[model samples]
Target: MYRDHSVGVVMPAYNEEGFVGDVICDLPEFVDRVYVIDDCSTDGTWDEIREAASRDAAADDEPVAETALLADGGDSALSERATIGDPVGRVIPIRHRENRGAGGAIKTGYLAAVGDDMDVTVTVDADGQMDLEQMPRLIDPIVDGEAEYAKGNRLLYREFRQDMPRFRFLGNSILTFLTKIASGYWKTMDPQNGYTAISGYALANVGVESMYEYYGYCNDLLVKLNAKGMRVADVAIPAIYGDEASSISYPTYIRRVSWMLFKNFCWRLKVKYLVLDFHPLALFYVFGTATAALGVLGGLWSLYVKYANGDPLFVRASLSLLLFLIGSLFLMFAMLFDMQVNEQKEVQIRE
Candidate 1:
């Protein structure tokens, strides 16, 4: 066990037959349990998982321990037996009857982690893009209490440029910027990077089952964490892009991320401002929105009156321009103040 913690790795898979074995095999020796959640893959992925589980058991320093594979229809009893039996030789795999997307599968693993009383839960995709060797670095911060959640930030470090595509790089940059504003984790980068670890307390408190099921999962989780007042930290790591095609389509991501931003912004305003009594930024946002709307309406009315010869063109135009400028300036200043307020909050927490 690394640093007196019961560490578990959650690998969510769907049709990952080609590299699932390699992903499982590459996990470090210190990990206590590797939970593989096969999200109803039609290919031989489940068969490969079984093969890998057996191989992993035999390759351990000790054999002859009872192995539990897939928990026989989500049985927690089997999970406990496989996890508690031997630290070295047992493998347990949990299978889902219906396809529940990757996020849902990881939620199952999170439930297992909590039920098993695991100290830490690490999620790495079964697609084999993540570097298993960096697992310890990701686990260290949470184990040390530096942060409740630690995530990989591929853009801040140099190794990320090796295999990353240009379009993906740009898109990730845009999403990360929006996530910082929405999630209040302004210090974080590469917000879409999925390799992450969280303490059992944070995971249990955040309620993983409620997280979004598709591409918006990570960003939504970040927003949920911030709403709970949990700390989030980022660790720089290398990027891996290969022959495997990403199942996340561009248009789907754009639509989902946009909607998630709107939802989280509204939720954060209600929770952090109205419910929790944090600050007055929410009031400022409201004022800015109202002022901007009024300015737009007045400007349009003035233009219509002037064009219809109902008023002096120069006087109406001047008044309209003045109102628009004031409203726009108020909104801009409000946004700037919000950024500063968030930055100060982070600094205070660090101190």
Candidate 2:
């Protein structure tokens, strides 16, 4: 165990036949278990997971080398010792009958980890894009009680940012801004990065079963964690891009996730400010949103009226400008209040 806490990695595979085995074999030795969930891949992903599990179970004394041959290939020459020890941990293969999203697979793994009494559970992608060696760094905050959840932040360094595509980087920045406002974790970035670790307490308390079961799950989880006052740490980790195919449509994914965040923002305000304890930030947000909407709409209507007829636009313009300025001030104050309230919840893990 790492830092005296039982570590488990959850891998969600979807048509990742080529990389699943490598990911499984590359897990750190300190990890106690690896849960591989196959999301009804149309390829041989499940077969590869089974083969990896067998190799892991068979290699009792030494690490086993990974082979590309099928499990039933019956090639004796392909069996070789791996570079690590005994494949580190036992591989538990879980297959879903229908194609649930990556989030669903992760929830399944979380449940299994909780049931097995694991202290820390880390979620790693099936496609070899995540560095398994960084597992310890990801779990450190949770193990140390500094944070209930920790997530990889690929934008922490310039070199790491250069590794991402230009378009993706821009998209990530926009989403990060939205997520900051929605999740109330202004210090965190890379909202889409899925490499994360969570304590058992968080996994059980965050209501995993009711979480969003799709690509937006990461952002959604942040909002829920914030509502529960769960501390979150942003672990600096590099992005690793490979030949793995992406299943997301950028435009569609962004739109859906944006809507989800808007809804989550409202829910958080209601649950945290209205139901749990009354806070002035809630009023600030309400007034700010309403004022901004009226200002924009009123401005547009005034412009239309001026063009349609020779009506005086001075009063309308002044009113819109006044409303806009007041709304912006309220929003700024609300943001300050939010940051102050959540300052203690931002976990800082020193390297």
Candidate 3:
């Protein structure tokens, strides 16, 4: 245990047979449980998980901790034990009957972690891209009561930025800005990064079951956390790019996640601003957006008419420009207010 808190690592595996085994073995001994969920990969991923669990169990100096591999129908009582009669295993391998996407698999592990009453839950993908050594940085803030959730930010350092693929770096940058607006965490970056740690309290309160079950799950979770007034810290960490290929299609992912963020933003405005606290920023956002759209459209049409018929119509053009300026000012002030309201949430836990 680290700092007298039981740590549980949630590993979500797809077709990562080779890398998954190594990841399981490389976990810090301080970790009390590893919930490795296989998302119904057609490969030998399941075998790798069991083999690695058995290997870890055999090599343990202390008695292996009791664990159950939930495989039968995904929820039935431990029907197929990895090792019969020997319930003491650190790695608890759970398999899904069909693919539930990465978020779904993590949700399964999350629920299991909540059920077991783990002190902290850390999510690390089974592709072996995340550095096991940097885990302490992610956990320190949560353990010390500084933040409720700590996420790894690879883009925080210049040297680390060179390691990421150029396309991914640019795409992640765009998503970062969009997510900051949607999640209401203006100071936070790298919304796509998966390496993160959360306290048990956060897990139970973040509405895990209703979390987005797609590539944008991390972004969606941030919005929920912000709405619930949970503290989030971004820890500087390096990215390890390797042989494992990403399954995501960037264009489709960006589009879908963008739409989802918009919906979440609207929901947050109503729930947090109107329904709960009743902040004026919500009005600023709604009216400002409507005013901005009207201004842009009016300005364009006025310009077209002026050019088409040589009609000066100075009054119309000036009025359109004025409306746009006012709208822009409203939006700017609303964002400032939001940032101030959530300034405490984006903690600076640089460890």
Best by TM-score: 3
Estimate candidate 2's RMSD in Å.
7.7
Pick by TM-score: 1 or 3, better one: 3
Lowest lDDT block of 10, candidate 1: 78-87
Q: Report the error of model 2 at residue 304, Å.
A: 1.2
Better of 2 and 3 by lDDT: 3
Q: How much does candidate 2 score in TM-score?
A: 0.90
User: Which of candidates 1 and 3 reaches a greater lDDT?
Assistant: 3
The lDDT values for all models are 0.74, 0.82, 0.84
lDDT string for model 3 (162-186, tens) is 7777987888888899899898999
Q: In lDDT terms, which candidate is top?
A: 3
Ranking, TM-score, top scorer first: 3, 2, 1
Task: Compose the digit string of candidate 2's lDDT tens values, residues 216-288.
Answer: 8999999999999999999888767789889988888888899999999999999998998999999999999
lDDT of 3: 0.84
Could you tell me which residue pairs clash in candidate 2?
Answer: 63-82, 64-82, 65-81, 65-82
Q: Runs in model 1 with CA error above 4 Å? A: 62-90, 158-163, 296-351
Provide the clash count, candidate 3: 0
Model 2: lowest-lDDT 10 consecutive positions = 77-86
